[model samples]
Target chain A: MNEILKFFVNQDRMLGRNERNLMYTLKYNLKDSRAIADNKLFAKRIFKKNKLPIAKTLGVIRKKEDIESFDWSKLPESFVLKPNKGYAGGGIIVVYGEDKLHSKEGNRVWVKQNGVKIYQSDLEKHIIDILDNKYSLGGTKDKAFFEERLKLLKEFKLLTYKGIPDVRVIVFNKIPVMAMMRLPTVASSGKANITIGAIGVGIDIGSGVTTGGVYFNKPIEIHPDTKSKIVGFRVPYWDQILEISTKAQIASGLGLAGVDIALCRDHGPTILEINARPGLGIQIANNDSLKERLERVRKLKFKSIKHSIKLAKDLFGGEIEEEIEEITGKTVIGRYVNMNVEVRKKNLTVLAKVDTGADSTSIDSSLAREFGLLNSFDEFMEYYKTQKHESKNIESYHLESILDFANYRGIARVNNGNGTSIRPRFEVTIKIGNVKKKTIVNVIGREELKFQCIIGERDLNDFLVDVEKKI
Target chain B: MESFIQTAFVSNPTLFYYLLLIPVISSIIAMGRNVVGVKSYGFQTPMLIVFAFLNGSGGIEGSLFLIFVYLISFFLKTYTKSFNLHYLPRIAVIVSLISVIFLIYFMFFFKLVNISSISPIEMVIYISISEIFITSMFKSTGNKVAFLMFFNTLILSILAYIVVLFIPQWFLLRYPEIDILFIFITIAFSRWKHLRFNEMIRFRSVINDMDKE
Candidate 1:
């Protein structure tokens, strides 16, 4: 702890809470925040005045009378309804074309991107709730506005699941400091909110390609549902995204601002919103401290927006990949390698296949029996079968004790050519050359397979695959 | 000059109470502003200063009456939904209601307290406290307003009471010019941009993240 404190003390570039408040009080005027923070309409007007590309506003409903007289049919097939003073992603409804499905009362239904059908009355009630400030930051009365729903760019559609993704860029002194692309997930319910389980991928400011990703604060490489690689996703129109974010920051007159930008299929990059006090989840996504970046650009003067963007890309970009590589200390292995496998106090040298497609490592059950691991498995299975017949509510500790007696870690579901079945998992230390790692491997009946063990990608993080290397 | 100071302090020691009131109020406002980031409109400081003076003169009983007014006004403002009243009219109602409550309390408990007569200054202080309460209620929710108003008044009142009771009257009388030091204190507080003590805990992650880098 003292070392950590010393490290922070030595980091002169890090911005603390005191410095943030001082910056706001000294550099930002309170009146300027009113133009962007209090009401979204005023912010849109400012964006329009500055000639920044923003989502076209369809209408603003300030009162119940406005909602009653408003023509709903005139709205586009797909649009977004949001509260003007809403914070985070609260009180936002995204409609994705009209559903042909019959409503309960046979009225017209609007289909959400998630496939939920909404009646016209439901939308009206939502609009009324917005007008009543149900989602406002402080419960002040707010206006409900309809905005053109930005079509997700083709590049992001594959990465996101049933939601539109947006990029959040933190700009200080008109220079982009750090940025994270928020991808909506099934868990986040089609809203790009990290707190609610959306994936936040760090973008390389220099290259605009995703360098890393985090889901629920844990580093992850693939989208949970799509199982597609999240890193190295080259964002389309990266320069335009930065330019619009910086322009929004300057237009809002906030010395430090979070600019949210989304790519529209037809309109290109559009400004979504400007946040005066953005959350700190971007730090977790980027695996970097914002304070250091903010302080680095504190005194630098930008001759133009293009110059500032270039300066930002030069200063804070391209280091995330190197930092990750240094931290993991990973080495490359091949598709087939000779390794010494140890299980239940016995070590056997065997040839193993490296398969990145598999989620977990698997070991042949015959090989396990040869090493005396099946004896404990039989003993545990006897106890488990007896307990299963006696009662359905088995204590977790008792189950853990059974696994401990059997020398197995836990159970996992394995899929092979035959079918999928549950198998007992055991802890195995595989030493490939001089590198040794203890990983959990499932014991399966793999008599027809050539290799006795197959190492999966989860255990392969410390080793990169050399596809052409022959063992 | 020394003789004049001695005579002035000896003749009217209560004047020192009013002089000390400025720092007490300014310190409270500055603490609230720096620590909590709450903004006060034009008259909050003057009203707090007046309340501090009243508390200094009338002691514990005056502090109790101020608290009673604050609580009653806060409750009335929160519970009375029928009067979705505008700003000025709502303040007028609250002020009148506080005055009525004070009148009833005075009529009943005048004998228990030693300070029986109400001065014009005291009347202004009561009205100002009521106005501040109403204005704060307008700006924030009931619980926050109640907590801030209650604590601000209680702290300033206790401080004023201590200064009145413990500080030697002769010290103030001899060095009346020492009161000017409050001006410098206020300026110093206004210019202080250091992190509040609580902010250190809030930003401890940034501090710890330094080690990771």
Candidate 2:
């Protein structure tokens, strides 16, 4: 009941879909400006005219006859085929490279990111589908275009699942309001739409370091597929991303727009597309309200895009959080100490190891059982014992049933010296000194270890771990 | 006697009553969007549909006619989508099919009723409205959403029709001063900046997250 009361305090600061259309899109985006943003071909031309970096368009197929007459051999090893008016990253095909095993000379076969082989006839059929308005926004007749695919950056290779990641910056009134880096996952089929299960990592405007991430509308600390840390990685070319996004918004004549930019290995940041009616999922990604940020800069004027970018960084930036942290001094804790943790509505003082090297917290399996945190896991294990399911075969059935129980967050893959192991994660509330935080902790068999619980770097944000202090 | 004829409109004031309801209709549409959070086609579409209801076949039949037109156009669009024709030609075919359906309905079905009650201009307005509905429906993201918006517009138009019919014509004719109150109503809507009713539920997660911080 108290939670319900707190929700209404910030209700007015959140923007809904209806209010976004009624206030921002309808008022700021004129018909001609929206048309420019809607058509990718025209928007790319505008970006090129303004000297912004964008992928080069090789050819456009407007009709079925164009498909038959087009030269397939002229295409490079890697290219992207997309509808000119596709929305939400729909109807896009990416060719990673040529199939060395299947292709000979003139009849070269290409391989998709998912390892599907694409022949010349398959490409022709796809072009015809695009021309027939299969992937176009509003189901209108659209043209199919071949574009140069940007090479993925080295830092992002392990972070992304099967495709290149892109940064989406929302530029409103010449100010880059908020930005998020979208990484495609295997579940999303390599598309960066958050609704389709891609990961959205929030970035700090003042600093380029990623602050947090949201996958499927829930805050996540690690990538589900790659098991790599999602937060704390600094985005490359932050200033250039903001500059190109703002310039693209101005060139398209849209007062409020979202510019999707990809970081290429050779070219730096390149514009992917501009959206007139951007989605509201960025708010969930950043755990911030767009209405508040938008309203803060609504009436302000800027002399230039650079000035506005600076203003945005100063006003809605990570420095504000650091300032608050400075005022409230962090608590000092030793490497090994006894911490108070709340379990099943009771306070239990447990010996915990403060380790800053680990990214997530983990508790011993026996300690978790004593605290009643393993009720659901124990039930699943009991069921597994009866079925005699092997460890490798438990992937499908174990996760589905365990996820149905309360407090079971998800699965976590831990890489150690021996090998990789999968563990079930649980949400627990722990108090270290004066700070109480609700964190996700993985359950592992730590009977041989000295301490029962290990506090990781994630839960040690408000604490200074003194290695030499004797507990 | 000419001066008396000019001032005599005050005594028999049917025209003044209708002219006064125009602002009333505009106010209803504005309030419906700003306060009640009902999105119809647009400001003009619903207003024109209301006028068509008042001037043509009473409110019920006019609404029924609109539903019939939308249903025909929606199904015809689905049927003809496979032809792979150009956009304009496909719309032309859908409109042509709709026209034939209208011709058959008017020629055979309404033979018993007084068809002369509806003016030729009103018939043209109704037909043009069908085209507008079809275009707007195609512009939506999906068929389900388009149908939902169409249903909302129909309901709002019917509500406006009821409001127009129930207001005492004699009272409006006598007190033309009451129409000035609608100006203040419009101003109130223009100044509305609070969260709408639908927004409370749509941003529930955002609100909770903010509270957590």
Candidate 3:
């Protein structure tokens, strides 16, 4: 036993296929649980029995005869046809929508995810091949089934290709260990497998926000196609994702499993499939080790699925925050925050946009008027209205003395994309989260926008921005 | 070494000549996959292909014959897939088509090669190799990937064949203890838990990123 422990300790942090299979997969997974996990239809039944949301089955083809007998016309406009025991996301054809020009009364045509047109005979041939064990783990006979293709959630519509992006949560002993959001890139041919060209973005176990990403086994900070920052993108329905994954792990009776859950625009978080042996690319995405994590939680017990999720979060959560602090020594703040704007020796709670793009802080004119900070600006604007068309030069206005108030600092030149104008600036103090900063802010009329205040770059010196956070 | 083996080991040493190559073949396949990261069909299949090459008319002729069978079987399999036949029966169709093609080739083209070096059983071995190609084709993602896997298997088999040919059998015949050493090598390869060299290259970014800390 000591030899075994020493052997494990001597192994590297990165897990290869052999170590993963010998240690975790073969050791923890039973034959019965593995059988269910290998078959997608059986796993879906288990998920359905546990009251989990899964894709609705459209049809099932058990044998070659069923291919000819089954009504191919009844398939929905957008459905996914997959082999029951397919591995690594193979032999799955996702029909995005219907082809209008090729559909007759009894015969219809559909478009694949790659924009290839499929006829009724083509669908039948695919099912026949699937039943012939074309995509099974070995050469065993298998079944083919069709399920409703999930609609992409609005949050991930831009992040994914034609397919829905799913989150793969590796659960062990009923505890969620690690997770990464598998995004479909164009190069992956609409499949979300990392071995193919999809992007894997690691999700913080505690906060459900993306921490880092791996594309083609290398760390990437932005989505290759979308060019949006990959880090700090908060995954929607995160708690429910963990809960469903844990429950699916227990339901399938697999001690160790990778539960894939896709976020549907209509059904919310839905279970896609479960794997007895999950891939280890997630380690590169998180820049961490799965072997160490699995060893840490191997003997852990939990009260319930929710309790297990809570325990998992507590054990491995917000690691990115600590890493950022270590590297930059700055507090991390989100894109939108509620800040305390000082008004007449009191604090007014104002929702502010933390924009690193702007150079200085700006406030809405209506908010400044209600707070009595724009009384001098009203008189100055009245004098500016009379001299607007008369004088093109700043010195011709002769209003420098009128613009001088106790808090009024100077005029700021502002460009609104089309033209430039001057706005009255003031000295103000504001508190963002826990930190307070004294800065100069320009008062502008921004009643049409969402926030009344926009915090700019100069006041955010002591912070690093998490682009997707909300406080 | 040849006289010593004939005098001490057995009366007919020619019968044991092919048996001595088994361990060397296993070692080549194991080390090729475990260290160099060359994926093939499996250990036994590639080893059998190497034996077939050694038994047939040299390595190059056997490789060319295997490639011909694969291309014919590949096209026949793709063409027969639209017939909606079951997997086994479809494979049978491809094998039968290959047999007919071979019968025609041997009838007209038998004079192009030395007839004494090629046996009818060796011809059967070359034809049956197409079955492996067809099964992998069914499981592969597409024709391009199936071709790639077949190409890799062919290359690995050719490597093993070259080792068996150029390396004098007298060496293994004299140093019979080397077979035991190869068996130990195979055993040691099974217990290897380190990351493969290809995986090291695959995960270079992750490894380098961690090394900085």
Off by over 4 Å in 2: A1-43, A49-51, A60-146, A149-166, A172-175, A181-240, A246-257, A263-268, A275-281, A294-314, A319-471, B1-20, B102-128, B168-184, B187-194, B208-212
TM per candidate? 0.56, 0.59, 0.78
Q: Clashing residue pairs in candidate 2, if any?
A: none
- Model 1 lDDT, residue A414, Cα: 68
Interface RMSD of 3: 3.9
lDDT for each residue of candidate 2 in A173-195, tens digit (9 for 90 to 100): 98999999999898787777786
In the range A323-415, model 3's lDDT, one tens digit per residue, is 655534567788888888886686789889988879998998877776666755566677767876664345434654554355767678888
lDDT of 1 by residue, A332-442 (tens): 456898879886668889889999889888887777777765545555566655665554235545665444435666567666677866677777778887788888888
Q: What is the fnat of candidate 2?
A: 0.33
User: Ten consecutive residues with minimal summed lDDT in candidate 2 chain A?
Assistant: A320-329
- The local distance difference test score of each candidate is 0.71, 0.79, 0.81
Which stretches in model 3 have alpha-carbon errors above 4 Å? A1-11, A324-331, A337-351, A355-362, A365-443, A446-452, A455-471, B1-15, B60-138, B141-148, B162-180, B211-213
Better of 1 and 3 by TM-score: 3
Q: Please, what are the lDDT tens digits per residue for candidate 3 over residues B1-213?
A: 666766755665545667888998999898878766776888877888887877778788888888899899988987986687766778888898899998898789879877679867677887887888898887675577788888888898999888888666666666777889889998888766667667666655555555345
Model 3 chain B worst lDDT run, 10 consecutive residues: B204-213
Ranking by lDDT: 3, 2, 1
